[model samples]
Target: MTATFFQRLGAVVILLWLAVGLAACSNFVKGGDNRHNIPLSGGVIQGLRNMGSSPGQGMVVRIFKEESVLEVWKATGAGAYRLFKTYEICAYSGDLGPKFKEGDRQSPEGFYTITPGLMNPRSNYYLAFNTGFPNKFDRVHGRTGSDLMVHGDCSSRGCYAMTDAGIAEIYALAREAFKGGNTSFQLQIFPFRMTTANLAKHATSPHLDFWKDIKEGYDYFEMTRTPPVWDVCEKQYIFNPAGSAPLNAAGPCPATVSNPALTAKLQADEADLANKAEAARVAAEKKAAEEAALKERGAAVNNFFSGIGSGIGGIFGGQGRPEAQTGTTTTLPTPSTQRP
Candidate 1:
């Protein structure tokens, strides 16, 4: 099959990004636990305290792909997590949403657990941590991938890549949390911020239903200011279930999310999203109408000049220029077909 211009252009851009990412990864110094032992900087420690959190309390990592933001939230004395820092993601591959399969080049989306064992100090790309892709939701949905990581060196094939310095601090925070006896932490990845407006913007995506399913967990965390206990049932995310019963990914969902406040919040967001979508539609139509009107006016002006040029040519017995350029249109003579 022949590739269209846009497809060819996209392939070229992807290759270029891969080249740069590989070069950046190669520049990083690897094979050392010493760098992993680097402590949190003074400014970071101070920033944590300002948010009522201290190093090693606990942490949750959230990534928003479209926004290119990775946020670190630490458990505060109040037991609720508070935003500690937001890091700019230097690189990530593929489009928004979950990875479909191995070598798909997509960075996975959805909830994951990052345990101590997932951390890698000797990573070829500075420090790194596996994202534990193909989590229950992915498995239930038959998704596949491996070695999905949040790593340094601004490189990514199917990973989230951060700058060396940015990831150093992020890795340090994770280390501190593990030292504080945390066996694992939640890693939530979203396509975007999941606001009502953002959802409205993507309401027509093929992944909208999937996104809405994940947004349940997102809403729970937003309302509670803590990671929601998540599990997969019936191939979708179920949050804060009531029972202690073990869940089967392929089986029917045994329990549903139980937060009334969050439910109310979601309902409101849906309503607001409808309004936002309508407003956006109207705005787009208005813009299109204005552009069409402008185009018509420009054409009228061009035709007026063209008529004048034709009249002048006729009056001057072809002494006027053979062609008349008007706006974006040029008039030319048709070849004679009466020759014997």
Candidate 2:
């Protein structure tokens, strides 16, 4: 009956209530109509169904830093992913390169995964999910950083920021995926679209090789329309349709079976890329040869003129220059020579 006892009881009740709220927010039921009070809008639900995606299904996220775009792809009943939506990124930090260390202000560019446990429903940025940075590849290279995220508020400091409305839709999509029994979803971040043209444009960048490695995964998804089974080995990425053998973060890559379809696609792509590169190289060489020939011709013409001029000068005993310089000159009167 004392006031102190009443206050303690009230504190316990408040703590319990908070715990329950958080639990509810984190736990989502498959095909559930409500989401811890923040139910999906009718429009969003309708949109998903219209796109042939159910309320709860698997999803994948792809981010392109150069374009400042995020694409959401949802799995269809046919076992392939279809593009669900594309959201413009409000802001992201750093330039087109992977985050190397803490305080680099660089947004990470690599394969990351978002799990149900990583969701932050009580985010200060309205809503967010941890990017799971410093992944195996990052750590293998001794890279360091932390707390990178995709969130709202349209501001960034080594994170991907989106509008509050954008985050709401994204968060809901992820929640539904989890509810549908997807424990985790892939998040593939890239410096730009991994096209042959784009790669060639940045051929001289220091990250070219790294980009090429990531492009394998990108191309796999593009071709199969499914998230590629990826694994990291000896600081490199390995992908296959059958998934990789228990990958070691720093150990050698286990022998993996190549999917025949993927192999054929990659081989064809490589041939195309090689042809493009060779053509570029040949064109550069031709340009250099033409420029060199033009310069040689120019030098020869100048030499011929010099020979003719030399002969004329020699016949005149080099006297024309002195004659040309013999014009009358007026000297100013010095102060001492002037009439005072």
On a 0 to 100 scale, what is the lDDT of residue 322 in model 1?
A: 37
For candidate 1, lDDT tens digit of each residue in 1-340? 3568889999999999999998766544463237988988899899889988888798999999998999999999899999888999999999987799999999999999999989987788888999998898888778899999999999999999999999889999999999988899999999998888898887767898888888988988888898988888878888887777868987887756567788889898878988987888888899999999999999999999999999987878643543433324465899998978
* lDDT for position 3 in model 1: 66
Task: Estimate, for each residue in 1-340, the C-alpha lDDT of model 2 and write its tens digit.
Answer: 6999999999999999999997775554323333323767898787778878876889999999999999999988788899988999999999998999999999999898789888877666778888999888898899999989999999999999999888888988898889889999999999999988777667667987899888889988998899977778888877762443467777877766666776787677677777776777788889999999999999999999999999887868746455445565556776676576
Provide the global lDDT of candidate 1 against the true structure. Answer: 0.88
Runs of candidate 1 exceeding 4 Å displacement: 1-33, 42-52, 318-340
- lDDT (CA) per prediction: 0.88, 0.85
Candidates in order, TM-scores: namely: 0.77, 0.73
Candidate topping TM-score: 1
